[model samples]
Structures are given as C-alpha cells and as structure tokens.
Target: MNLAYQAKRSHLLIGLMSGTSLDGVDAAMVSIDTDEQKNISSVSLKGFHYVPYSDEIRERLMALCSVETARLDELVVAHYAVSEWYAYAVSQLLAATGVSAEQVDAVCTHGQTVWHVADSTPFPGPNGMMPVRASLQIGELSVLAERTGIPVVGNFRARDLAAGGVGAPLVPYADMILFRDAKKGRLLQNIGGIANVTVIPAGAALEQVFAFDTGPGNMVIDEIVMLGTDGRQRFDEGGKIAAAGSVSRELLEPFLADPYYRLAPPKSTGREVYGKAFVEQFTGEARKLGLSFEDTVASATALTALTIAEAYKQFVFPGMQAEEVIVSGGGAYNDTMLDMIRQELPQGIRVTTSARYGIPDDAKEAIAFAILGHETLMGRPSNVPSVTGAARPVVLGNLCF
Candidate 1:
C-alpha cells in the first residue's frame, strides 16, 4: 500500500544498519518531504529488507568484536570490509528496486558498533576533561559514496560525544519525530543487540522528552545461545528454546537488582559491560550454584524484558506518562521475551511492535538512520537532548562527499 502522501517527495534515501542483534543488515528505502518548520515531515518507506549475514562473515565479525589491541589492525580492516559488504547489499537493493542512482539522493549507513564506552573517553589534550566522549563505527561512508556514487552520511555518534553526551541510543531522536502520538504518551523500546527506550510525552515540547539504555537486550541472550548451542545458533530463534526452559528467579532476582538498572537516565552500555566478560561472570556464578543451561538462557531473556519494564515504570513513565510501550528490533520476534514484557508491564500499558505504525519492526532502525541522513543533508540536528543529554540540539552525522 503506497501511502498517497510520500508520492510527492522530492528526496529518496536508503538507510542501512547492522545493530546489536548480531543478526544481519537491515536496509530501508524511504521517500521523505519536510517543510520549513521541519514539523510537517512526511515519509514513506518504499522498500525494506533484513539481509542475514553469511556465516563466515558473521563469525569473523563476532570474533573481532571488542577484541583488545592485539587485533586492532584486523578490526580496522574488518570495519572497512563490512562497509563494502553493506554497499554491495545496497547496490543489489537498488538494482532490485529498478530505481536508478539518479532517483536516489543518498545512502545512510549506521556501520557497526564494536564497542561503546560512552561512560569514558580518551585523554582530551593538555587540559579540559576528555568529555568522556568517543565512539567508533567503521564502515567508511566515503567508500559507500564512491561505490554507490551517492553522497553518504555516516559516523553519526561522534558529534554527540563531542558535545558531551552518551552517544548511544541516537535512534530515539528519530523515534520522537516519527513515532510520537499526539493523544497518548509513547514509550518506544528497541531491542537490538542492545535495548534502549525513547519516551515521548504527547503534545509536549521536544525538550520534554527522555531516553536511555534499559540494559542488555539481545547481547546476553545471543551470547548464551552461542555458548549453549556450541556456536550452532547465532541467536535464540523464536524464543522456542527459551520457552522450554525455566527461569531461575534466585539467580535472576539478583541480576535484575543490578545498579545499572537503577542508574539515572542518559546512561549507555555495550559488550564491554555485558559482553564476553559479563557472560563469563554470569556463567561462572551459575556454575558455582549448579544452574542448568536452560535456566541460564531463560534468566537472560527474562532480565532483558524485566529491565525494560522496570526502567519504564521508574524513570520514563513518571516523567512522560507513557501508556503504551511500542516495541521494535530483533527482540520483538522473541516470543518468550515479548510474553515476559506483556506480563511484566503494569495494567493499562499496552505493548505493540513498530508494525502498528506501518514500520517493519526489524527495519525501523535502518529506516531511522536513513531519516537521520535525510535530516543531516538538509542541515538539521538529529539529537534529542532529552534522550542523548547533549549540550543543546546540534546537527549530527558526518557527511562523506
């Protein structure tokens, strides 16, 4: 169903993203039209797809992720390789669309995040604090521009970090604009490799918004799947295996009570906190207590859902008065996780996927980056201060000519 509104657009952009889900690249082709106030923005996603990563590349990427300096050079090469890979995906997508390069205005790529240490930063020269600001997403946009012969806007996180923000959950800015409901408060929860939320108060000023990381989303669950299945599975498909297992409340209770869950908003985390080390600690403790593999996976999934609901109640709802939690990302496909969230949510707060708004849950993030690219090319700020904690609104994303 082609929405009649977007047919009048003057710009069409394709956005690509490979999120924390560690699943595959999601590419979305959107045609957008914005007005002088930037308030009258209309967009239609003309096409979208989730292309799974080849086993070989997926393994290699996973192997290099969050590795120490010993593999720094290798990781750098991997980043560039992934960019080319994404370009190839985009080229195929365009070819399949029968839309010429001339018909497309740009390609927006989220690249890939290996590690996000938004809590700290490298030394900032001879004086002031390092701004605790630095993030790396390596899929050279210039190469994408060169290969696709389309102006590309990528590396969107650096600007936020430069302005003293967590530089994570940048997608919330897109959520605020695209998903806000004028009648009811909206809590947009994305369960990618990482789970984060954006709270938009209906009819409130932009500054009244708030968003942040809710804790490990698919990061821990994927790790457990890989380990328990001996690398046979990239993820816990459909939550079937998880549903068959039992959650260890004793173990899960303590994990849920983690201080990170209690921390104030604007906080961020990555594999650094919930990665291999975190898994090792979790497993080691489980072993010490003689927990079963099923128990481990079940608890990890529970933690992901519980943390989101807990965060919403404590921080977001109180401020935004959210009555519905719109879900998206790979986690939305996890039936067990969804069940936990639906059960865990307080009465009156309904849970639904991005599909309710005509956006494919899997491709929403990729589409969002494409929208951000649209914003950047038009000389706009994509940062939501309430979400990113940045110093005022600033135009984000680096343009690679």
Candidate 2:
C-alpha cells in the first residue's frame, strides 16, 4: 500500500503522549484530512483516553530521569516496559472508541522524555572532545508497533537534533497548522512539566514562527507539593494549596533570576535543570526563610507564571504582539496559576485555554503528534527550522512497521 497516498486522504490516527508530568499516557484518536497541498485541511477528535502510570512505574521512570540513579540495566528493562504501557494505552483507547487496529492508519507517540539536554556539552568523540546535544525518550517504537499491529511513528526529536536543532518545541509546526490566524497573532502556551510557548505571528508563514521553553510549569510546584506532603500529594490540586498560601518574594526573586529565562529562542529544557536536585535546593532555600509548605508552593507557582510573562515581555512583545495566549496541558487547570499568569501579562492580551477553540487542553499535544505522524508518512518536513534553529527543515520521526 502507498503510505503517502493513504495519508493524503482522510485517515484515522491515534497519538500517544506521555509528558514529563509522569502522570499518565494520553491517547487521542483524531480524524485528519489533508488538502491538495498536503496541508491539514480539517481535523477533529473522535475519542480520547488516558492510562495512569502505576506508582512503581512512576518511580522507575523517575529514577531513569536522574543521571545519578539511572542504571543501564534499569534503562534496558524500562524501555520495553514503557512500550507495554503505551500499548495498553492504545488498546484502552481502541476499546473506548470501538475502533480496530486495522482500521487505524498509524500510532504516533512522543515517548516519555527521560533527559533532554538541548544545550551543547563537550563529550569525548571518536577523534577528540566534541560539542554534543542529546536527548533520550524511552518507549520502543518497534515494540509498540508489534503489540498494536499498526505502524508506529515516534522518536520525532532525533532527526531534528541530528540536523543541529534543539529537537524540541516540535509542536510549533503543528501549532501553526492548528491555531494560526490571519488577523491575530497568538501564543500557544503549553504548561506541562515544562512550559513552552509557540509564537505565531499574524498571517506568518511556517518560517516566521518561533518557540522556546519558558521555564518550569508544574514541575517545580509538583515537586514542592510532593516534598511538603511527604508524597501524600503529587500536586497542588486546582492550585488550592497555592491559593491558600502567600507568595514569598524572597524565594520568588531567586527563581526568577535563573539564567535559563534570559536565553534566546529555539531553546528547550527538562528535568535536567529543574528536576529533583533543583527542587531539593529550592526547598532548602525556603526552609532558610522559614516559609510554610503552602508558601513554598505559592512561590513556585508564581515563578512559572512570572517566567512565562517575562519571556513574552522580553522576546515576544518587542517584535510580534500576540492578541491572545491560548494555554493547554496540565497547567491550564490550575486556577491560581492561571490567575497569576494573567496578572503578570500586559493589558489587552486575552488568556484562555485550548478548550475554547474545541481542542481539549489535555489532549492538544497528543493530537499534535497525530498530525506530525501524518506529515511523516506524507514525506513532508514538519520541523520548523526557525523554531528549532536547525540547519534546515527536515521530516521528523522514525517509522516502525
């Protein structure tokens, strides 16, 4: 069968995304149709399902994320195990939607990112020391394809990285396909474990778009909540803990001073910079100030909000003024976080969730991967060179059949 021909027509694709949140796998069943130019003409959600990760799996994955604790043996075991988890998610999605594996065209997955180092670090090469940018995502695509009996498209970051790009914020190309407008410049802000923004200038072409990770989204706040409650709570539900507490400028000031905030676009970061160790240090500073648990959570939430607003003020506002900030991902549900972000942003800019545009906030990323997977099958270059700082635009994802 001609995969590209099939992709040009209407097709059903399931996108699976397990973000840094480590909460669960989101499976989005999307119906996509491409225009004569092979650009997405119409897209709609058919069904959505989520599979929560067990405590044991979460612990194992968390261990793999840290360099100090990640072992080769564990990585080998978890790689296949995570594929099983992804298969389970696909099965559950099929069951929920009453669809068959043969009926679907492909399974697009953005495997769980364990470690993402977008910045260059010197490492021993074949000849000598060389600057390398590396990232690893661990769900095996072959295993997922075998279990699901459908072709799989995944590891979407590797090709971009190979082309001298940061290999992230890969969703900007998809964001343009889904949210771009002719009259209004929009900022697509996704607040997952890490918060990233895609700036789509009004009526801009794909080459004109750009994006970068603003800073920690729910990552730092979730860590603080877990630390404060002794693992009793994984997150501050509805931002209630933060709402109940006070923001300590003492703690917020230092977090705002993080050098990552000042970095130019085409950048990305993950648990590497703001993971467990960073949270431990943050908690130590909070203790030095004698701050309460709620106060610490509040301050961390403020850091997310302020950093995002600051990124926009410094980078986005000077060139393209976005009329709206459309938020998606786990952070969209955090009322206190949303309120803080709104306060920090300038006047006349609207803040809203992706749901307002008919895309579920939680399912937006999953749906994006589905579109990306379709592009891969159609032999299209989906990576935005401007957003990723790649030498050139390139098709992303490794296909497994």
| TM-score for each predicted model, relative to the true structure | 0.93, 0.98
Candidate 2 — which pairs collide? none
CA lDDT scores, all candidates in order? 0.81, 0.92
Q: Which lDDT tens digits does candidate 1 get at residues 1-401?
A: 12322333467889999976567788889888766654436878898866788888776676666564227777878877888888887878887788888778888888887767777655756786544666777687777888888778898988887787888788877887788777998888999888998888887667877789999999898988889898888788889778988887877767777889988988888766787777888888777878788778888898898898898878976665667888899888898999999898778888889988899988899889988887777677888876777887887888776
* Candidate with the greatest TM-score versus the true structure: 2
**TM-score attained by model 2:** 0.98
- In candidate 1, position 354 carries an lDDT of 91
- The segments of candidate 1 whose C-alpha lies over 4 angstroms from its true place after superposition are 1-9, 36-40, 67-70, 122-124, 128-131
Q: Highest lDDT, which number?
A: 2
